[model samples]
Target: MLLFVIDLLGRTGPFSETLPAGIQAVVAGSAQKAADFHVNPPPAAQCASCHAEHFQDWSRSSHARSLTSEGFLRTFPQYLDFVGIRAREDPQVSMACFNCHAPLLKNADSEIIRRVAAFVVAKDINKLDGFEVGCVACHAEGNGVFSGPIRNPKGNLFHASKFSASYKEASFCATCHTWAPASIPCSDVYSDWKKSRAAKQGTTCQACHMAERVGITAVGLPQRKIRSHIVPGGRSADLLQKAVALHLKAAFRQEHLEVTATVRNLTPHRVPDG
Candidate 1:
């Protein structure tokens, strides 16, 4: 089944460019900026102020360690180096990844953007931790923001505040979930979901995956009225468990035993399984 999906996705690669303008932009831009770009951050400490509880929850999740982990680093030593090379060779792609993964704060001055761009071009992966996708990376504000900095991206803006009705909506997830039209078939989770019955029925990935442990029909636990920020549940836990299990398997295998493991995506935006 997975191979079928991959083949189907591969078939779509050539035709994907025929998708709409916005989709084309995403695909082309994502491929182009896989490495280099600059982005300013939002005001400092504002993210924490807005999502204190959620921030804590996210810190506990594996997603928090997306860009930083000794285990991941040891296994994929070339990620940073490759990013650097791509940044120099393909500034457009570098910019795309940087925007999604290591977004800058709004308060970051112009110089900050310049430095960020330079670092991205240099493939300075260490900066990934300091300016990585975090709790605010998704929830703070912007259209279709997943994780990372929101460049000069503009649209109906959402702001976080203590007194207002929270505006954490599906569009936020759509930013990352939706694939650029021109991208390969495997790259379009967001768009796939958008066309799915889930989206039409107003069921969001967050609703099923992040809500408290009430019945699937009623996940709104009284104490946890809002959704969970922990970002667990769904097949994600299954996937992560697979990662750990693979590591355990590797550890148990004799190092001297001749074996080869092809780690497909030990880097950002690449498919881990596909």
Candidate 2:
């Protein structure tokens, strides 16, 4: 649960027929059920067909690489064995692990689960790379539609679109990030955020990670407020540098020089955190 478990874990369309600013497109189709997303979910490439830019930014994010990330892949088998050996029962390995890495695993066909588990058992981790936990994980929810802060005005004949306020709230992230809330354990990122100055001042996880930008999210969309999907964290050198500052001074004594150093934290929350 230390390095491997905790490290895991956004994105448009159309060109002509732009609608008025802040107006969502009129839907000609009913929404799909959540079941549609939970089983054999469409890959990010499907969404990339329309929302190219958002998909591009998302591709660079850790979310895109969660399953195949070298660090996690190297340790995942150990984790599975640890759990299995301890429980000594039918270990629903894919269900427990993929809940965060690949939500589509839940209620998936038995064959899909078997193949994924087989890959894990054989140490053929690379096979899992093509299996993407894409748009369905966050945007598709109980509402039976893909959602965002702003819906694409030039709607597609494809899936139904809707606007959801949950996309604008940090708690939406807690869906996966909350490993232990009451105990405020290392994995409880939401808890850490609650104690942060950013939380007190209303700065959200999206403010620093997703970075606000004004641009067309999809091909036909007009320039409106949008967030980048880059989502940098401690692994980003520039972001880490910005989180803290250091100062030093020296003074000459009668026979020697004395030096003093100070470190100042500039971030809303703790640095070098789990």
Candidate 3:
């Protein structure tokens, strides 16, 4: 039955009403638990005041728009419908979508998940307006602790700051970028990179997505190699165009034309990766 469901999902996307009873029950149970969980972090505005440059860059990134983007808004409902779940009736089902898009809520207790799911189902966008993938989502470690890659960050008057080596590693991005939920490979970019030459050379997701820049992480801090928050990905047409090189060769023989093209992927991961 599990194999059957997986096969069916592969062919039909995530929107199938004929999923096995047991699978549906499992999904439903997970949804119930997710609906009950709820956690809220500090707003982006709080971070903006101190890390102006980082905040500004993030404001224009896809991470900031993850939840509210038109693509996500449209696809989320289709996913729910495919899985035979309703946002209002079984808000827990939406947890899978929120796990990455809204990590803050992903940590929430079951009750809070339910409450927030209700708001989502009712289309009450304002209720969770400021709680999308904001600055605090990745930087803040629950409560008030904030973390980053800087070893010895100096001048920070607002909140508690800490240095974490993990921030500089590619595994940090695996949390979301390589996550496979419900037997579906959602974003396998990290997995692809792990097996790539880049990983062997100690290259990390930050190396590409968050390119380095000489700037202050926060107010009153010295200039340093701070990772930019621009976070470009596959959607970046300019980046994509430059990520590969195409070489073409043509020959004519006996009134016949033959062409050979060699494509090289400049990036570590697979071309057209998520």
Query: Which candidate leads the pack in TM-score?
Result: 3
Q: Which 10 residues in a row give candidate 2 its minimum summed lDDT?
A: 1-10
lDDT per residue for candidate 3 within 1-274, as digits (tens), equals 2222111111212424464344454334333333322213444644565677898998888888777777776677677768884454564677887888777776566666676665655566666654577777777764346788777766433346788888888888888887756545366788888888989998888887888888977766677777788798888887788788989999998899999999999787777755
Model 1 score (lDDT): 0.42
lDDT of 2 by residue, 1-274 (tens): 1111110111122313343321222111101212232223545655665576788888888888767777556556666667676322333665566677666667566667667765655667555653545666777654346778874445654456788877878887776776753422226677778888778988877877888887767667677777888778778997887777888899999989999988887776566773
lDDT of each: 0.42, 0.61, 0.67
Task: Indicate the worst ten consecutive residues by lDDT in candidate 1.
Answer: 1-10
State which candidate, 1 or 3, has the greater lDDT.
Answer: 3
TM-score of each: 0.44, 0.73, 0.75
The top-ranked prediction according to lDDT is 3
Ordering by TM-score: 3, 2, 1
Per-residue alpha-carbon lDDT of candidate 1 for residues 29-145, written as tens digits (9 for 90 to 100): 333333333212321222333335555666666556544544433323343355565443444443444455455433444455445555544456655544556654644434323
Candidate 1, residue 252: the lDDT equals 38
